[model samples]
Target: MDWEYFFELLLGGLTRGSIYALIALGYTMVYGIIELINFAHGEIYMIGAFTALIAANVLTMLGMNELAVLVLASVVAILYSAAYGFTVEKIAYKPLRQAPRLSPLISAIGMSIFLQNYVLLAQTSDFLPFPSLIPELEFMEPIAHIISSAEVIIILTTAVVMILLTLLIKYTRIGKAMRATAQDRSMAMLVGVNVNRVISTTFVIGSALAAVGGVLIASHIGMINFYIGFIAGIKAFTAAVLGGIGSIPGAVLGGMVLGWTESFATGYVSSDYEDVFAFALLVIILIFRPAGILGRSTTQKV
Candidate 1:
């Protein structure tokens, strides 16, 4: 059999899952903290990619090395995305913190539309080419045909980020505060946890993660447009739901599952049905495991 082709698809799925996990983590984190979907999260990812593209071009024009350019671009993207996330929370969400859930959801949709148009008018409707920031390694030359250096970097980055994030959530002071806030916001506040800061921090962290994903994926795909975030955001949100929206580990697992499903469908079936299969998988998961693969089913008394 075509074992080589099988491995190629496997690697491809792994890379796709990495990006999805990064973006899905944001959705799950925000939902875990505030129980809000933060619909504009995808636009933040798009903005991060655009910011990285601009930074990379400017650095490259000045003759900066690819490594330096990549580092600077990633930093700029993360900072920019984080600031936007903070501002969005303050402007679009904070004032309505006590309002009906639908209020913020509508506001989120509006914010997303505004960001998309802002980018369209500020940048261009055309797709922009993104430079490859991952350096090639001599050791990977043999297996490069099955998985490129960029894919390797993407997967490794995701793993490192996941480990670091897990540590942060488990051991850091702010991490403890976050867990406290998520468990009981009112009680957390009573016990001296800054709910507001925790919420903002959650947004910042989530946005930063998505920005990293944005840069990595844009580099891998070679081009990006303004609306790329919308599709990616929807898929990531699906991953969050599939893995359990309020569960962090679930987001990672759901993303990997979704990515593999899409990859196999495209490789064995047809490219046109890739999304169809992905969403169909989501439907099946929802029907059987309504709380998600790792999400717990909870009931609230009226």
Candidate 2:
């Protein structure tokens, strides 16, 4: 294998990893704050892509340039997705909070299917092409030939958002409430944290991040379908599990690792086997460290 080819593959892997990291953050945050699986989170991602697509089209009709359209579309898509997420939590999850865990899980799955079919019914089952907002520019020198605009945008955008999230979780008052709730819901409530508000806020933030991921991935690939989230969701969930479901930083690490693994598998092995490789890695990791890379084992008191 040529060294240059290897470097290219690595770069591609990093770019894909960044996308996975963003999506995984959503999964990790929701899972951390509430033990629910939120199976519909992936469907939220799919909706976000469509939302961006519609927003971009509207912007285009309004005569906005590519850059402006991208910005508008992103803002609109994120807001819509966040609203949808908050609503889903309120309607589908909140009421089930005190109910059986299986009930919530089932509702999540139902929501996922409903969103998918809703999209399919509204839009044809055919894959619709999403207009490219970002130019596909190469930034590196001839010999290096290292980067693509998509990769740069994905890395820089995700880095900025991650930094902001870190700050928000560390410094903000609501962030404190969220952390407190995550630590002990009943205790946090006793301490005056509005558990409902915190949960809704968590869902909003996660959904917004997933919306960003949806836009990025759709822009990168240039086409989308209702089912796009299914595989990505599984991979992201795997990343969250790999890194430690409740750990934010762990999700980032897990996403990057999963992305690179898929890239290498596609480059060296077969693209067809990429999905298989991801699950295999997950299985291997579980076999060695059941709790996950950053997950801690806790003792139960009887």
Candidate 3:
């Protein structure tokens, strides 16, 4: 066994896992708050990537520096993606809150389809090239042969975002309200928490995180298509379920594990079966530990 080759795969897995973690956070957060799966969340990530692509082109035309352009483009993409998230909740989800569970589930799937086609029509169906705005770090030249600057950015960004999210959920007034609502929506309302506001905020925050993932992943891959969201969404959903669907930390852990699984499978076995490895792992986890690594099992009164 080549140890160096193993380490290379490990680094690659970490970079991919970081993106999955960001996307999974959206799924887990929405589920944690409303007990609903926002299946359309992945499309939000795709749109964010497109938004960044357009923004970067516009900024480049204005002759901005690479760093400034990247920063501005990211900001614009995040804001636009958050708006879409808020709109999705108000239109597709809010009215169906009291309906049967399957109703909203279907609605979410429909929304996912709508967004994919919308992008296909608005933007070309072709794979668009994403700009490489992240500059190489000279200080890391010694290890540049092993790990690229983009991978470093991905890992650091994931860490920073996760820390900020943890702080927000722990310290802020809104954070407390979110926790209360997640614990018990009826009880939270009785205590004066605005259930609607909390739900909207959850969508917005989750969407923003997805946007960040989109921007970073697009930059890393250098190309994207309208269909990119579907596969990524499924993988992220699996990660969320594997880690304990409603557990925040579990999503991150699940993503990393899934990423590593794919990497090692591709390295040792066959690249064609990489996805099979992920699903196979998901089935095993479901059979043995349905609640996930960090998720708590709950019992309901009949």
Candidate 4:
């Protein structure tokens, strides 16, 4: 067995899983709070990448350092994405809060389609080059054969983000409110929790995370286009469902499992059927464990 080759695939899978977890975090969080899938979440991620690209270009023309440009561009993307998230919730979801579940769902899909078309017309269909934010460090030049600096950063960042998010949802006041809202929206409101604010906050947090994923992924891949969101979003959504749609830890676990599945398949078998293996694993898991790896089975008394 080629040990070096095996490690390379392992790290590659970790990187892929980390990025998927970043985006999946958004899907799971929003669903945890509002029980909505938020299909438009993916478009928010695409917008973030585009926003970062535009910001980086402008900053480079201003002769900023690489670090400064990356930081500023990512900030711009996150804030802009948050604004869009807020708008999406208000426009596409808030009005239909009391309506049938399908109402908001259809609205979410429509919003996703509208944003994709909007960006297509506004930006060229061709893939545009993205700036590399994570530069190769000199220290890692020796290990470059096994892993890249960007992959390391991606894995580390995802881990840190997951830890921080876990803390936020566990200890903070907003987190407590979110949990309450998720458990019982009507009871939360009765207890003076601003359900609207919690829901909006959920969207904002999810969008910001998605934006981070977008910027990092664009930098890693070195190019992106308007349609990138749909593919990434679908994979992330699958990760969420596979992990247990409403569970945060489950999302990350699901992403990692899916990532490793694809990577090992590509390494040992063929890249042609990479996605097939990933989805097949998901299907098998769902068949036996419908609640997901870390997900709890909840029975509504309704």
lDDT of 1 by residue, 164-184 (tens): 887999999999999998888
- By summed lDDT, which 10 consecutive residues of candidate 1 come out lowest? 157-166
Better of 1 and 4 by TM-score: 4
Instruction: Write candidate 3's Cα lDDT for 85-176 as tens digits.
Output: 99999999999998999899999999999999999999889998998877788898899988889889988988888788889999999999
Off by over 4 Å in 4: none
Model 4 per-residue lDDT tens digits across residues 247-295: 9888899889888899999999999999999999999999999988888
lDDT of each: 0.93, 0.88, 0.93, 0.93
lDDT ranking from best candidate downward: 4, 1, 3, 2
List the pairs of residues colliding in candidate 1.
Answer: none
Which of the predicted structures, 2 or 4, would earn the higher lDDT when compared with the native? 4
Q: Which stretches of candidate 1 lie over 4 Å from their true place?
A: none
In angstroms, the error of model 4 at 141 is 1.1
In candidate 2, what are the lDDT values of residues 195-287, reduced to their tens digit? 999999999999999999999889988999989988788888888999888778888888888888999999999999998998899889889
For candidate 4, what is the total of clashing residue pairs? Answer: 0
Highest-lDDT candidate:
4
Candidate 2: count the clashes.
0
TM-score of each: 0.97, 0.94, 0.98, 0.98
